[model samples]
Target: MNAKSLVVIGIFGIATPALAAAPTIDQLIANPPLLNAEMDRCKHLGMAANDDPRCQTAWKAENKRFFGNGVRYSPEPVNIFRNTPDKLVPAEKQQPIPPAPAGAPHG
Candidate 1:
């Protein structure tokens, strides 16, 4: 391959994996609120957000371990890696019920 092409490929190879890797909650938090992960292992394990690299690594590992390979993309991506399994609350946690007025059924 040509020298220029080799250099381009080298750069692309390094950058591609970085982008493809699962993102950390802190990474998502740094930007606007977006997708949520199902299991924030970092916080669950009592790690700091500053430990983002370690978090991402563990997140991917555990994700594949439990759900099998390639199941990393949950309905809520980053939230999974950033919240507890039982308390992985989503935005739609509460459903609105009609408020009962005075003397309403069981009010």
Candidate 2:
């Protein structure tokens, strides 16, 4: 065989394994057993699932697998200023600023 043919064959051989290793979209869609198995495992753990590290990890991974790594929606709007004490307490509740000395320049 020509050197060019041999090079092409070698490249294909290297790439074939990589291509085979990746799961296709169809394969992923068809894989319900894993999801069901994980659900069963977590279900069996019940309330104790929260304390089980392995169960927690599996649940998190399953959630990400199904929901994807996207922004989550909440029924209630998130308060960005939740941790800020100033925002929580109204300005009126705070001590009023002392008035400037009489005849003092407004500037």
The candidate maximizing TM-score is 2
Candidate 1 stretches greater than 4 Å from native: 1-41, 44-51, 70-107
**Candidate 2 vs. true structure, TM-score:** 0.33
The 10 consecutive residues of candidate 2 with the worst lDDT sum are 20-29
lDDT (Cα, tens digit) per residue for candidate 2, span 46-98: 89878866565566656667887677887777667766664454455668799
Error of 1 at 51 (Å): 6.0
Q: What would the per-residue lDDT of candidate 1 be over residues 1-107, giving only the tens digit for each residue?
A: 89999999999998777545565544554433322342454566565644667566555545554565464467854654544685645686678898976675663
Clash count for candidate 1 is 11
| Candidate 1, lDDT over the whole model | 0.58
Model 2, position 11: C-alpha lDDT score: 95
Tell me the TM-score of each prediction against the true structure.
0.22, 0.33
How big is the positional error of residue 4 in model 2, measured in Å on the Cα after superposition?
61
- What is each predicted model's overall lDDT from 0 to 1? 0.58, 0.66
Model 2: runs farther than 4 Å from truth? 1-32, 71-107
